[model samples]
Target: MNPPKRPGRRAVCLLVLFSVWWVAVATVGFSAETVSSEPQVKAAFLINFAKYADWPSNAFEKANSPIVLGVMGDNKVSEELQKVIAGRVINGREIVLKRANSIDEAGACHILFISNAEQQHTPTVLDQVKGHVLTVGESPEFLEKGGVINLVRKDQKIALEVNLTAADKAQIKISSKLLSVATLVKGKAN
Candidate 1:
């Protein structure tokens, strides 16, 4: 078998810098388009975020409780997430994808992906998952609505807006590495 390839110094440096830039430009002037690959990219982000975040000891019911990722709408993003996370394990916990149409149904999840269809119910959903779930959304007003993470599209590229305040209120601890690549914000959810 061939030896595994490692990232070079230049590659590592670029990654670090890219993380910072990705978050910084989330709100800059950019037009939105129906990017065909958006779902795949977002699914990857959702998984990677779990790898870089630390959940509280009590977040799970047991030592082996799977990390439940809840989807709250019917869309390509949910389907893509299911495909990407199938049979994957993070930190020894198997990943589970659950689809829900209501707040109560999604209450037990560790991570909740709010679909555009549910954007109107953002506030109610946030209230339901408060102090527990890591909420993610793609709407421009998601952060203002108290979402933990908002994915913004800029020039066809996805950028992240991380609300540190919201995460703190939910008692979720995000990794410094992940924060380094996201635009940090603080405010009450509207």
Candidate 2:
């Protein structure tokens, strides 16, 4: 054939992309300002979460509808998240974002990201999602308050704090790979 197509342009482009992704996460080490730096990291987390989790049949199995990402309280974080996950798809479903003032309104989301504004109402919200949704937050007390994933800033980089107990109670299975890199917070410890 024609010079046996070398591991050329396509491969080079992929390599570059991979390099960029790595650099991004490395820089995202522990800062909220840089939180938007590695969009792929967030995407990877969502994808992995889907693989390890078992969503309620009504939300995932039967209908096959889009997986919804819900944001409660803070509008800034929601806006940032929307920009990052705009056109991304996970598990054969397009990702959609919904804003809610109350947990009752956000009940349908597969992942609920609670903002600092929601702190005062977290207990009630957590109660509503006790055995259902996966809760994510950026508050310092997130893990202590039973949130499944806490996004914390450390050494100016963004790190994750995971609450296995909360995830287990919600019937959401977090991947060991994710847990391995994250700081595990057990209710008993604190």
Span of 10 residues, lowest total lDDT, candidate 1? 27-36
- The digit string of per-residue lDDT tens for model 2 on 118-184 reads 8887766776664367787778887777788877778756688899888877777787887887899
Give TM-scores for every candidate, taking all chains together and pairing residue i with residue i.
0.78, 0.70
Off by over 4 Å in 2: 1-52, 56-58, 61-63, 188-190
161: Cα error in model 2, Å? 0.8
Candidate 2, position 7, lDDT: 80
Output the TM-score of candidate 1.
0.78
> How well is each residue in 37-151 modelled by candidate 1, as lDDT tens digits?
8888988888887787778888888998999888888579888987778889999999888886777767788888997888788888887664478888998888888888989
Enumerate residue pairs that collide in model 2.
29-157, 29-158, 30-156, 30-157, 30-158, 31-157, 31-158
Deviating ranges (above 4 Å) for candidate 1: 1-36
Instruction: List the global CA lDDT of all models.
Output: 0.81, 0.70
